[model samples]
Target: MAFFTGKVALVTGGSSGIGRATAVAFARQGAKVVVASRRVAEGEETIGLVKAAGSEGFFIKTDVTNEADIKTMVEKTITAYDRLDYACNSAGMEQQPTPITEQTEETFDQIVNINFKGIWLSMKHQISQMLQNGGGAIVNISSAAAIRPIPGIHLYNASKEAVLGLTKSVALDYAKSGIRVNAICPGGVKTEMFERFTKDNPQAADAIIQMHPMGRVGESEEIADGVVWLCSDQASFVTGQILAIDGGFILQ
Candidate 1:
């Protein structure tokens, strides 16, 4: 049987990048998938990809930072699949890449609410459902910046650091309960967000690439593969850990 056969997974920010790839990966492994994001059109597209992967899929318009929206997203998932097996909390926004002094309270709050609080709220509901269903796995998408410095985007770094803390604490709290929580810290990945962030400065992009010892940026699918393994039985012994999927970027 397929590794994830008879399983159900929810991917937040499933509209694009790592989230989209993870949703497809789960579906390809025979898992029913629920794609959640604020972008309705993109979420629908991701569900199409999930269907093309030969598994059933559903999309819920979700704003991760909104408590009501998050609760509804989980409720709808239960209504459709009857149970939740795994989840990838990949919904987040990129930092504006400005110095700490230039950053305003507005930007700081935005970063915190989505990158940190969003995951907390997600875990709160997801864990509740998983407990009811027996147990499950959760993977939060953090960043390499959480471990190493990436200059400029201090707020982003702080937010992601909080993600790791939350992941570890929750994992420990539920270690005996069957719900496994972990975080993935990916290094410079080449995604639409990356392109947009660097479109105005080719030199900055080149510098970013050179920072990785692998001589290249990582891919969304590459990270997605790690997420799938972490959510699968193969990683049954793993939890409360931060898996850095960076291409040796932190070594430097």
Candidate 2:
């Protein structure tokens, strides 16, 4: 049988990058997928890709930072699938690289609201729905910056570190309830986000690639594969852990 033959999954930020890839992964594995994002067009594109992979998929316009939107997302999932089997909290934003001393309050708040609070809000609604269904799996997309500081992107680094903490805390609090929570710390992946980061900072991009002992940037699909495994029965015993999908970057 397919690993996720009858599962249902919700992927936040599913319009692009890691979230988009993960959404496609779930659909390919036979899960009914709900791809949520702020961009309707991108969300529709993600749904098309999921359908091409031979799974049922739909798009939901969502802003993860909004409580009402998150609540609506959870409601829609339950109404459509009757249960929430898995959720990937991949919605986030990275601030423009700026020295700490020069960072503006507006940028800092925007980063925190979307990257940190967004995940928290997603978890809040998703967990509640999962509880009604007996159990579920959740994966939050963190970053290598969570463990190691990135000099210019201090705010981004801090937000991801908080994601790590949130993952562990949720895992412990809900283990007995049959809900598994984990986080993935991905290295530089060749996504639109990475491309944007590198557009003006070629040197930064090159240095990042060099740090990865694997000698290349990671692919979004590669990180998505990890998300699939974590949500599958194959990872039944895994919880409260930070899985780094970096190309050996953490080693050195």
Candidate 3:
């Protein structure tokens, strides 16, 4: 039997890229998925992918930065699935590269509200539901920038770093409560976000790609695979780990 058979996974930011891939990966492994994202159309498309993977799922229009929206998203999941077994907080935004002096408070808040606080809010509600189940796993999507400093986008970097710290703290807080919280720091992955980050400077993108010891950026599926593993029984003893699924980008 599939390891995830009879399990249910709730994935935020299910609209595209790593989020969509992780949801489908769970489906392929025999789990029912609940996809949530602010993008209704693309999120629906992800539900289609979940079905195509031979599993079932539905989509919720969710804005993670909004507490009420996130609460409703989890509420609806329990309403449908009757139990919450796993959650992947994947919805987030990226800031354009800019020096710290040029970065505004607006940009800083935008980055933290989504990348860091969004994860916190997500865990806040997800843990409440998970406690009822007696146990569950959660994976938050962070970035390699969290630890390794690049140039601009300090806000993004700081938010992700904060996520790691938050993850470890929460893991200990819930250690005896049957909830395992973890985070993933992905290297440069080929996604719409990456494209947008590099659209104006294709050369810069190429340069970034070559920085990886693997000589290329990672794919969405590769990172998805890591997420699935971390949530599986194979990782039952693993929690609060900042797993780097980068293509050896940190090696540099």
How well does model 1 score by local distance difference test? 0.93
lDDT of 3 by residue, 91-122 (tens): 88888889788889888888899898899999
**Estimated TM-score for each candidate:** 0.98, 0.98, 0.98
lDDT ranking from best candidate downward? 1, 2, 3
Order of models, best TM-score first: 1, 3, 2
- Candidate lDDT values, in order: 0.93, 0.93, 0.92
Q: Write the per-residue lDDT of candidate 2 for residues 39-136, one digit (tens) a residue.
A: 99999999999999999978999998899999999999888889999999999887667888999998888999899999999999999999999999
**Which scores higher on lDDT, 1 or 2?**
1
Extract clashing residue pairs from model 2.
none
Q: Worst lDDT window (10 residues) for model 2? A: 91-100
Runs in model 2 deviating more than 4 A are none
